[model samples]
Target: MKVTESPSYSTPEVSKVMDQSRRFIATASDRPEDIVEKADTEIIGLALQMLSDGTADQVIIVTNDIPLGEAAESLIPKYGFTADQVTWLTGGELAPELKEDFVSEFD
Candidate 1:
């Protein structure tokens, strides 16, 4: 589980959470089907809407509480987005490998 913040988390906070998740994933080998008892259905619909309406270049996180992957996946057919449209928010692990303007100023 990730600890998200309102108004979004900073790069440092995101890094911290990702690091902890790596440790947890390494230690606890649990299946998502059995792990998550109550799923957030609202998020799925919301994400789908955002994905359909929002541009691929933009990340529209309406409620910061929603998981990034969950939110992105919900978009699916809305905007014709594949895994390529979404990038894991890696602090710096693959920054050198990125070709898109993920951190660039938007118009």
Candidate 2:
């Protein structure tokens, strides 16, 4: 339940994480040429930073963006986290009760 701002993009660590995330997204695509860019790099960079800095052992990136989730899943291991330690939850996959609450709050 902790909320924190994304790490500054100017930091070398954040920049590195963002580059890694973009590369992962491009590689995972069927049409790498069609992939323009990842707008969620900042979020992905922050998540990686938490794991890298020992701020969190596990991170669950809940989002409706499929590419964002895929990149996070693919790169988490490079940040020293196992697949089990990272989770990606799409909005549709949330439990029914929680889904309603989550949607309502956002709406």
Candidate 3:
């Protein structure tokens, strides 16, 4: 599992969210899957790079935005990636299982 974020998260509010996530997963390392600017436009490319570089055979994109998920789906075939190779989570469906104490520290 890897985490990816836009460089724009350096701003105050987004940085707060990033910090909260880090603090919540205190034992985890602070490294990201990749740090790139404009994730909205670059994530698909990054995914391809990961695949081509053999860094990941499968990728699960966890996001809150519907369109971002859709865009990823549309680009999958164009990049010779298969449906099973990519997974999408547009909601926090996986969040419920996280430790409550860690989750409550955010939002």
For each candidate, give its TM-score against the true structure: 0.27, 0.70, 0.53
Q: Write the per-residue lDDT of candidate 1 for residues 12-86, one digit (tens) a residue.
A: 433333333333333333325333312233333333334444523434333222243443444333445666554
Higher-scoring candidate on lDDT, 2 or 3: 2
Compose the digit string of candidate 3's lDDT tens values, residues 22-96: 332332323342431244435655565566557789877766544445555655545567988877774455685
Candidate with the greatest lDDT versus the true structure: 2
lDDT of 2 by residue, 1-107 (tens): 45888676776777887887777666655445335354577778888778777888888888866667888888767766799878999776766555664542112
Report lDDT (CA) for all predictions.
0.36, 0.73, 0.52
TM for candidate 1 is 0.27
lDDT of 1 at 92: 35
Those runs of model 1 whose alpha carbons end farther than 4 Å from true positions after fitting are 1-29, 32-44, 54-57, 60-79, 90-107
Maximum-TM-score candidate: 2
Model 3: ten consecutive residues of lowest lDDT: 22-31
- Reference-based lDDT, residue 25, model 2: 61
Greater TM-score among 2 and 3 belongs to 2
Pairs in steric clash, model 2: none
Q: Which ten residues in a row have the lowest lDDT in candidate 2?
A: 98-107
